[model samples]
Target: MEKSVSKKAEQTLKKARVKYPIGVKLVVIITVLLLVSLGTITFLVSAMVSSDVRITAEDNNFTVNRRSATEAENKLNTVRSNVFLLLDMLNAAGSSAALSRQASAFFFERNQDIAAVVIPGSLELVNTRFFVSNEIETTLITLFLQNEAAAVRRAVAGEPLLINAAPVFGVPVIAMLYPWQESGYEQAVVTFFSSEDLTESFGSGANSSFMVNDQGDVLVHADYNLVRAGANMANTPIVQAMQESGDRNLQLLYTDQEGNRFFSAFRKISIGDAAVITSIEYNIVFEGIAATTRRNIFLTAAVLFAAILFIWFFSKTISSPVRVLAAAAGQIEQGNFEINLKAKTQDELGLLTDSFVNMSRGLAERERLKDTFGRFINKDIAEKAMKGELTLGGETKHVTIFFSDIRSFTAISEKLEPHEIVGFLNDYMTRMVRCVNDTNGVVDKFIGDAVMAVWGAPISAGSPMADALNCVRSALMMRAALLEFNEGRGGEKKPIIKIGCGINTGDVVAGQIGSSERMEYTVIGDAVNLASRTEALNKPLGTDILITENTYNLIKDYLIVEEMPSVTVKGKEKPVRMFAVVNIPDANDIPGAGAKGPRTLAEVRNLLGIKAPDMNKVDTDAEEQKYKIQES
Candidate 1:
C-alpha cells in the first residue's frame, strides 16, 4: 500500500512539474497586477493636479496684478485731474490774486498726500498752501527741471509721465504731471504725492507691489529705502521678461539679488513710463502646493496601506480554502480516498470544496466496484448507473440501433490462450467502444465479440435523422477501427481483425432490464432485432456495414450505398429493404436522395444505376407465423 501511494505521488509530481504551490503564486500575481494599476492611476492623477495648480496660481497672479495696477492708475489720474481743475478754475478767475486764492482753497481741500502743483517749463506754483515755503517750491522746481526733458517729451506725446523720488523739501515724492501747450509755451500741472500713497493703494497680503521705470529703476515701492535711494533692478528676469514681451503684461518667476526666488506679475500701465509689478515669494506661492502635496502623499500612503490589508485579507479568505483543497487533492492523488472538507461559506470556492469531498467518496466507491461491474458494462455506463441515470423502467423512444460483430472471432479465440484472448478482446472492445461513444452512441451491452449501441435514447442527439446518421457513422468508424487495430499488430502471427456492422432506425423501448439487484441498461423491440439481423447478413453480402431501409432513407444522401433484396422477416408481412453502405462521398453527394417514398429511390437508382432486388415471391403463411421472438 505504501509503495502504491508513493508511485501515485511520483506520477502526480511528474505530471505537474510545478516548483511552487498555487496560494503564494496567486497572492503575488494579484498584488503585482493591482499595484501596477493603482500606481499608474496615482501618477497620472498627480501630474494633472500639479499642472492645474500651477495654471490656477499663474492666472490668479495675473488677476491680482492687473486689478492693483488699475486701482493705482485711477488714484494717480484723480490727483492729476484735481490739479488740472484747479488750474482751469484759476484761469477763469481772470487775475493772479483770484488764482492765488483759488489755489489756496484747492490745496487746503485736497488730500494731504498731494504736496504741491507746479508748472514744469516756467516752474510756476500752479497750486500751493501756506505750508509750502518758497524754498520748498524752489527745490521741487529744480528737481522737475533736472528731469524735464524726458517728462516733457512723454507729456508732449499725449501720455501721462511719472517721475520717481523727485526732491521736495528734502523728502522723496512721486511726481505725476500732464502737459498742455498754452500761449505757445509747453506748460504742465504736476502733482507731487509721497510714495506712501502708492503703497497704500496697492498693498496686498502675501504679495508686494512696486512701480519700475522704463530704465528698471525702482519708482514707487513699499520699501522707502529703495524709493529714496533710486535702486536699479534692470537685470531682474521679471523686468527683462516685460521688456521682451509685446503684450505689455508679463507673469514670470524670478530670483532677486539676495537669491530669493519669487513669482512676479508686471503690467506697463498706459498712464506713465512706470510698470506696476506684483510679486510673491516662491515659498509663499508654493506653500499651498506643498500642503496639498503632503495631503496627497498621506492619502496615497493610507490607500496603499489599506490596499495591502485588503490584499492580505483577500488572499487569506480565498487562497486558504484553495490551498486546503489542493492539499486534500494531493492526498487523493496519493491514493488516499479519505477526505473531508468543511466548507462553512456558500461561495463558489466553498461549493468547490464540498464537491471535492463528494468526488473523493465517489472515487473510493468506484475503485471498489470498477473491476467487477466495469468488465460487464462500460465504465461510463456503470458510473451513470451509479449516478442513477439508469433505473428499472423503460420508455418507447425513436432511436437508431447499431450492431457490430467481429468476423470469425470464435475461431480466433480458439487459437489463443485465455490471457491472450482477454488482452485481444480488451484492445478490440476499447477501440470499438471509443468509436461508438465518439459518435454519441450509448453502448447497450456486449454479447461475446459483438457490441450493441443506440443513439436517440435517454439522451437523444436532438432528432431522429441525426441519430440515424450518427449510427451509420459509428458503424463505419468501427470498421475503420478494426483496420487500424490490425495494422498495430504487424509483428504478431495473429489474424488480421475485421468487423461487420449494421444499423436500423425506428421506435424502441430503452431502459434498465433484468433483475432489480443486477439490472442492465439496454434497448429492446423490433428495431434492435432488425439491426442484429442486418448485421448477420453482412457475411453473406460480403460487406463491412449494412443498414435497414429506415436508416438507409435517413442517410442515403450523405452515404454511397447499393440497394439489396427486400426480404420477408418473421416479424411482419412486409419485406424489409436493406442497403450496403460503401462510404460517404462528399458534402454535396446526391440532392434530395433521402426524402421518403419511391421518387427519391427511383431518381437515385436511375441516376446512379443502383440495382434493386426483385420483390417477387412470398414464403408460406405458417413460416411467417413462426412467432420468432426478438432479443430485448
Candidate 2:
C-alpha cells in the first residue's frame, strides 16, 4: 500500500511540473503583449505630439509671413499712393508748356512736400533745382547725370522712373520722374523725394526697405550707410528677377551680407517713364510673431510632457489588477487550483478573473475561452466597452469642419529623401493637429501633410462660427511660432508652409463611423466638403484663412469681413463668396480706416495722364532752349 501511494505522489508531482511550464508560457505571452502595447502607444503618442509641434511651428511661420507681407504691401501701397498724388501734381503742373519752369518753381515754393524738380531732356538734366537754395543741387545734378543717361532715355520713352543717387553729406536722393510731352516742351517731370518721407513711409527696423529702378539701381533705400558705400542692389536677384519677368508681386528669400536670411517682396511701381521697385525684409515685419510662437510652443511642450507623465502613472495604476490576474493565472496553471484570487473588487476584469479561478474544474477549457476572447477583442476595448464607449450610434450635431493642405507637399516630398520626407510630414502634421486641438478643434485625420478637423461636435459650445474663428486665429498664431524653430535650425530650409482653412456651419451625421472591428468618431456631410473646398481655394485667392459664405454670414457682425470675389469650387454650380477676417480694428480707429494718407505718385500720374493735354503754345520755347543749352 505504501509503495502504491509513493508512485501516485510522484505522478502528481510530474503532472504539476508540466502544468507549471504551460502557466509560465502564458504569463510570458501576456507580459510581452503588455510591454509591446504600452511601448507602441507611448511611441505613437510621442511621435504624434512631436509631429504636431513641428507643423504648428511651420503653419505659424507661414501665417505670420503672409500677414507681414500684407502689412508691408498695404504700407507700401499707401506710400505709393502718396507718391502718385505728388506725381499727379507734378504731371498736371508739368503738362503746361507755358508753365514748365513756373510750375517747377510753384512745385518748389508752394508745396513744402516737393523737395526739387529736375527736368531731364533726352539724357541730361536740363533744369535741376531744390526748394531750399543750397549747394546740394549742384552735387545732386552731377550724380543724376553720371551714368544715368540710359535710365533717363527709358523714362522719356513713356516709362515712369525712380532713381536713388547718393549726394554730398551722405544724403540719399530719390528721383521720382516721368516723361512730360506737351505742344512746345518735351521733357520728364523729375521730383526729388525727401528722405524723411521714405523713413516715415517704410518704418525703421532691422529689416531695411528700398526702391530700385528697372535697371536694378538702388533708387531709394532706408539704409543710407549701404547706399553711401555704393552698394549696387541692381545686380541682386530681387532686381534681376523683376527686370527679367516684370512680375509685379515678386517674392524672394536670400542671405544678406551678414549671412542672415531675409524674405523680400517686390512690387513694380511705374510712375510714367520709370519703374519703382519696392522691397522690404520679412524678418522685421514678423518679429513679434516669432517671439509669440516661441513662448507658446515652449509652454505647450512643458504642459504636454507633464500630462504624458500623469497619463503613464494613471495607466499603471489602472492596469495593476491585470498584472495580478496574470500572476494568478501562472500559479493556477501549475496545478495549484487551491489558490484564491481574493480581488473581489466590482471591476469587470477582477470579476472575470475570480470566475476563472472558480471554474478551475475545467481550467484548460476556460483558459482557451479567455485566450480567444483576448485575441478577438482587445483587452482595453473590452474593458472600455464594459465601462461604456461601445454605445450604439451617436447624436447628429452641427459641426464646423476645417481642412488644410500644404500647397506644394508633393513637390516638397520629391525634393527630400523618403526618410526625410516622412520626418518632415510627421513634424508638420503633429504641430497642425496640436494647434487645432489647442483651439478646441478635434483633429479627425491626416492625409499626408493635410489636416482635417471639426469644431462644435464631439465637444462643443454650440458656437460653430466662433469655434472656427478661434481655430483660424490659433493657426495664425502658430505661424509666428515656427520662425523661432527655423531660426534654431541655422535659418536654412525655411519651411514655406501655407494653410487654407474653411469653416462651414451645418448639421452633420456625427458618430463613430466604421465596423465594430475598427471605428472612428467623425462627422460627415456637405458642410465638410464646403470646408475642404474653402481651404483649397486659399492658394488661388492668395489668402491664408478662408471661410464659406455661410460662415461669414454668421460671424460678419463680430468679425471684420473682406468680401472676396465668388470662386467656382469643385462640386458647386455657383461660385461661393468668401470673406477674409481682417485684424481687429483699434478702439480709436474707424472700421475701414486705420490709417489714411495721400494718393501715390503713380495714381496721380494715371489720373492726370488719363486726359491728354490740349496744349496751347507759348513763346518760352526760345527761352527754354537757351536755358537748356546754357545748363548743358
What's the TM-score of every candidate structure? 0.48, 0.32
lDDT of 1 at 105: 64
Cα lDDT tens digits, model 1, 292-387, are 667667766777777678778766867788899999989989988888789755455666777789899988877778657777776667777767
Task: Report the number of the highest-lDDT candidate.
Answer: 1
Q: Model-by-model lDDT, in order?
A: 0.71, 0.56
After superposition, the stretches of candidate 1 with alpha carbons farther than 4 Å from their true spots are: 1-87, 90-362, 367-372, 408-427, 460-466, 487-497, 585-632
Model 2: number of backbone collisions: 32
